[model samples]
Target: MSDVQINKTKLTYDYIIVGGGSTGSTIAGRLGEKSQNSVLLLEEGPRDKSIYIHIPVTYYKTAQGPLLKRYNYQRSAEQTPQHEATMVQAKVLGGGSSVNAMLYLRGNSSDYDDWEKAGAIGWGYHDVIKYFKKSEDNNIFHNKVHGVNGPLGVSDCAYKHNLSRVWLKACQEYGLPYNPDFNSGEQQGCGFYQVTIRNGRRSSASKAYLSNRRDNLSVETGCKVLKLIFEGNRAVAVEFIQNGKKQTAYAKKEIIISAGTFGSPHLLLLSGLGPKEDLEQYGIPVVKDLPQVGQNYQDHIEMSLVYKLKGAFSYDKYKKLQWQAVAGLQFLLFNAGPATSNIIETGAFWWSSQGKKLPDLQLFFLAGAGIEEGKDGVPGGNGCTISITQTRPESVGYIKLQSADPYQQPLIVPNYITAPNDLKTLADGAKLVQSIMSQDAFKDYVESSHVPEKPLESSEDFENFVRNEAYPGLHPCGTCKIGKDELTSVVDPELKVHGIEGLRVADASIMPNVISGNLNAVTIMIGEKAAELILNS
Candidate 1:
């Protein structure tokens, strides 16, 4: 059956929300709730309501499974020909929220503060905290920082394998405090991972925010939106293709783009709203000639270190009965068990393990290992993982259009570790990971560092390892950067493209600098706030 109820592209809407992912789903539902406003949501992939998608424990399988990807993206590092990129994104209905680790986390306190300082008017920490509270429903760990009856359900992992406990002890032994909650004022700790799961199922934004209104909201999936059809600088409609046939859909009030960091800019460029030179190179007509549409791309870079443990661990070990049985019991019963784990055992924020002025690095601990070069699975012996990432790297790269075709993949050149400071940050983070791993707390539990276990015998060895091992975070941002300067900003503080009318961007692309944590929650908040701004306007 078709997901769309109406067919005419000329039908006007009070609001047209493109890309029905987390933020798109939230904004669309919020707008539709008013009863007076009409909203239409366009998604490129199929429905994101797979059985595995709802089961939080099986999210790992979803990430590695065939049903997850829509775009085939891979980039090669410039310094190392052998070290490839690990860029995975869920292209289905709910977008990444359906396929991610499902961990529930708002970024560090300063992330929103940075956005406010960067001229993102009315987006300070104080402003966004209310939205965060409005979006979540915490089953556990409730306090000043959490909300009890929100749309998104937040819960602690049901399935706590033995290794996660080891990680906590290791942290305690290594002088890392066991922070009971990362969502509170600070996020530095080794404790249970929190997930967006309710009764053992994934509670994605679409499932939560768009829960009961599937029928009222006009949604068209499997329809790849090509570009906005503008009438004299005003966005009148969007052109898309479904089942190999072209279609146009109009918006009377506005067309909001939530195509994420990659899709948003690419669509803008195709719509003739991007830099003139890039549009000319592809022989596409230029509309507004905004140069910053695809420039200033930023993302966190992570290098996974998997280890072979003494006993079997379950998060990725698919063999053990305890793991399999728990997964089943959790789903069938109270929805508690291995299926509840978000897989991010514990995460922390710290200064560039190299002592930078800002806490620009992050650490993640997982209960499984063996994902070498981003593809290898866990071995059965028993293991867990730790990752060191440059939370805000100085390096910048961009996405370029290969052609005007919607099916063609955009040219994604991340230019990983191009700047000297980027390399320095990663190396320092690597060193810090080494220090944490070697501390007496973790030393008793951890056998040896799997990737760089040799005590970094020399600086050259560490640098070489970093250059070859570093990978781009799935959290790509700033492609359609938000700044005041015409030379660098794509959208103004209000998220409207500088030279266009009846249009705006509401996605991670508007982030000026990559925040120091997983960026999913912040992106959803952006959509919510953007809708309010647009509705008020």
Candidate 2:
């Protein structure tokens, strides 16, 4: 049978899922499992067909290339007055899961427990761990915390750079223990990251869940959702544009907005479901006066400490044409080589201060420098970077509609490093990175610091360095957060939009607070839990 296409003939479905990203794809796939219901998934971007998305090492191309949407944002005036930063988000079908480094980290268990304490009822660690296990198909672990038959594949890196292994050893030598699993409720230690890859191919949400051809599921790409149609206090349909033609699709059961942190809140504001004053200014008809629709934004901010390497040992060696050809040939013939590595294979978690019970800092060791955009490599061409991130930032930002026009991008203000603690934590993390590099394990490979060019001997110097160099971690969350009421949050614990029936926001936007690690794994767990909630309802 032909896949169902969005047309005048079929304008209704049992469920309408906006955005074919991680959570949206999971919900649509789960709901479409039942033969009694039909699902329609609309994605604003094109299908996930790019070659850079599947290759593990080449994912940086997609992350820095045209597949992403860049938003120019400003930091808080008090912290860095008039300072502008660029935030990039995935704009493809599978979202970040398709473009990310594919690290499978669940963060610390206390992160979800803290969520319960913060008004996200039934979202505690114990309540949510099952969902995490349900979404994971681990290749190494088979226990209560991991699942063996799940759809998403989690495995060790097919190829690891020698520098990554050396870095791991250096981390252990620097006083951190070697932790085999970071997802086992405790997150402090250095180790290799298990990625979302299988047999040298990326296993994105679309690949894990939506790859099966199901008659009940209809996925439409390049469909931009303009607004939601409502009756009284209930959402009934969605108005979108596909191939430049305006169309309306009614929902029989519910309309889930899984458009991610920025997209979800942007859609709500466009549909007039935000603060009354803000909506009125945009000339939009107010449907619900939810004050916190685009408020309480949170994200992780990181600073990279780049160092020059003594020899051509890092992945930067592949910058030459001959090395690229050799690696490409190995990948094509045997599916094994440097091309199979994600580059960011090893990392660690630790506390910035001595008293903290949980680790406030996360570190990623990149074997090559100048990999990400806007970052500079060493002059001699061989380098490495130790990116230190302030895991839980107190700095909050927001996303607001620029105008009433749906085509215009939203105003993103990620007010990063406004919190004093965040800056101090990152400064301390930089000291720790320097300590790790100074260890005897890295003595043979280390040349000199490329970023600072001088030793940071005092607190003021580290703080100054952080102020000049820290950047967004690109893990945006908590915008349309889940909370006790509509005044402070957009969705409830059940992922339902408050004060509006038949509507829910099931993406990272619903996170009460940003977790300590990457958002992809936890976001997928949210999708699994959301599917269960919808199915049980």
Candidate 3:
């Protein structure tokens, strides 16, 4: 199952792709398609062979299991008291796509348009839509806006809990539109999420892009990249450790870093490509004095509103051993059942009651309670959860190296809710979700409350609840953003490092801003586009 051979420590390739995650796997696959160029992908984690990784419902287990590397991930001490957000960075071949809820969401078009306005020229919605279409193969949604034939499998959830429709109806009652598609450029609506699932199994990045391996590609899992080998200002090679042994890989054309939002910046600092002060503080030599290497961190912050259901309409019935057996049998025999559905199958994107230019808040309606924070345990009876997340935040954070050693975890300060408006927006979102769930359509399903425990008497109480309970939405990005200048960004429009030659970054880490929804689909588009950039270069 391991791709790294102990005897093969030194090698050469046309492209060296670091971090075999969502974007890295895609780029490696595309580059290997023609066999004209050799591509090498190095992943810090093991191969994606775990059964839990393939089951759509076991995503929580993947987060808590050995497959994920949990970091210190502390929040801003100034805003919140003592709390660790515990960011879940996947340690597997397929990366977050292997461990996530598998919701296939492309952020609003304005997300990319805003990117272009913010210095990433040629990355506007119209320019990037082709790449998104190039990677997707939608099974149900057929339109000029969506692709029907592509490598990545995109399908509607096979099974939906009966209560999901009621949830949608409740959203309608709350005045939101009932749009069937969320990825059609317009995102203000409530509907069932089309997921990255195929034939009742998880369709991860590795499954989609690396399943049919090409002879020209070398996928080295369980290999931790130590640093880059720089000749003057050019990154010519990579140094890594595999199976307790040191290894080196040389790239002839270019080295593309796709180690995700946190890992990418961490690797850059380790390779002497960060701020001179930080490199000196850690006793590491500085190759480029890019002060923006680990700055401009942005992420979605969320809080949950839980309610106990009056009937057994939610997936809570599956908690019984008997019901579990039935659902497993159905999945094994027919590739259809509650087991195939990621409980977060339906949600909404809406502006606050006060309205906005774009949908700034997102709601994930889960047909179960205790799913958000698993430690609470499954509800004794039927229950449901409505989680509200702020998609755009004015507050920014940073990532810094804690030590010179690559094994040591970096210091990640998301600095959540530092801006007063950010907090106020989330507080408003909290009230909105509470109101939507309290709609008459959910009258029969409602029983009681848990997180808020009771009605919020005032706006101050809601804001306090949000401040006390909100956590990172796990969509961390902008650590190594793309821009026009080195002083403000890490990568250029072509995704190349600001001052380094033969090096580029192709991951969420290069995103100038965090989008309004899940990040996996856009990350894949980044890979597809990076391949085009490299092949043309």
Candidate 4:
């Protein structure tokens, strides 16, 4: 990537974008295409230069590494006794795209349709598919739903473990049909996932959008924006800290906040654009009293079922020095091996209960257990994991300002599985996965369950397991939702902030509801659509 420093004297630009993440990077690249439009992108984190950020298999390390910022969360008081739950947000130029497993899922088409029905006009499946295609450069499947010449690269996994293939066959033998493409708008059935990897390296938003030198676009990293500088409800500038020095930058035309789900709403609340009572409590003068600014939080929650393997058939064997050396040499020589795999490559989508029109559960089959932090391996040191996720959860939460300090982490409450239906759906999904793993196809490879440790013979067993073991899917969104008015939403259909002039929000935070799949692809699509809206406006 080019290292073009921002001129201290020339701090004004036509468009100023906060947060150089997936959405922010895309907007900067697209808006900079027009030389007349000067765009400035500011990221609080450093540049995406770490080796871990570029490799496909280093996701496990980068996910918990310093490139991410962890925020402590909790369930509501009525749900259970207070316990510590944590969620991580990206803190690099490419955001989650730089650190995530790189799964390229757009969710079921009905997800966008549901967004449209819920007041996000002009955002239905048909309306938003073009944007999804607009940013993609698929190495395979040159069809209407996939794009070929876009900056972001989408390709099939270069390597898959033998056990991963076996899991796919077992899912099919258990009932699901093989799905060739999940991004084709139909997300049901078992299949291998396409990823955001190109040439065996991660195709992060920073590499895709900001790698090329653009004279019109200037990206400044390690700059933490303190607050929006408003002039009579018009956000014209931002005051921030850079290199331990406070600085101010002016926007000639507009300012767009693309700070993801948590940061975006936290920025708004810090800038006095949220609930009047909450702002007053923190001594922040109310600028818009938009009650929905930090409300309507949503996320996907998942629970894993781990099973021991009869032998060293999975990637767990590679933890040894000899196998690690072999795998390293294979990748360095031919760009292939276990190192080329993203680990969570194969997955399936199906209903948690019968007679449901759409699938409410998504399952990911990992070739090795104890791969991710907070997970365990079996006594024999050979195991695999199947994680079941509730795709469309009914539970809602919020993000509130912990204090007036911009550096303080926000109060994040995902309230995961607080809703009765969410718990039931997850329990049902676990049962379905249990049945799939029990199929004869897995008999040669599997031994016994290692997580639940015992057979869950009753509904209560499943429910208790889900409640105790469920974790965040890391797909947080909907804090700054899009809708028709200020009473219920933070931004309008055009993505412009309600009642605030010259300010817009374009990120996953504006999602009316969380999609039924991963958020990275859809978040990039939002950046594509947001740029178009701004250009048209």
TM-score, cand. 3 vs. native: 0.96
lDDT of candidate 1 over 1-537, digit per residue (tens): 122335553556667888988888878877777766777889988887678888765666677765554444445454665533346666777788888878676777787788878877777788888787777788886666777787787787766777667666766776667778777867665566677887777888888877785444687788889878988888889888888898887777888899888889888888887878888988888878888888878888887666655554436555467668766875688766666676675766666545665566678887776432253544445566778788768778888888877668787777778888788887777776776766665545555556654567567777887877776667888898787766768888888888788888888889887877787778778877887888788
* 201-252: candidate 2 lDDT, tens digit per residue: 8989989999998888899999999999999999999999998899899998
- Highest-TM-score candidate: 2
TM-score of 1: 0.92
> Between prediction 3 and prediction 4, which has the larger lDDT?
4
C-alpha local distance difference test of each model:
0.75, 0.89, 0.87, 0.89
TM-score of each: 0.92, 0.97, 0.96, 0.96
Flag regions of model 2 displaced more than 4 Å: 1-10, 78-83
The lowest-lDDT stretch of 10 consecutive residues in candidate 2 is: 1-10
Alpha-carbon RMSD to native, per candidate: 2.9, 1.7, 2.3, 2.1
Error (Å) of candidate 2 at residue 445 is: 0.9
Question: lDDT per residue, candidate 3, 297-340, as tens digits?
Answer: 99888888888777787888888899989999998998788889
Query: 1 or 4, which is superior by TM-score?
Result: 4
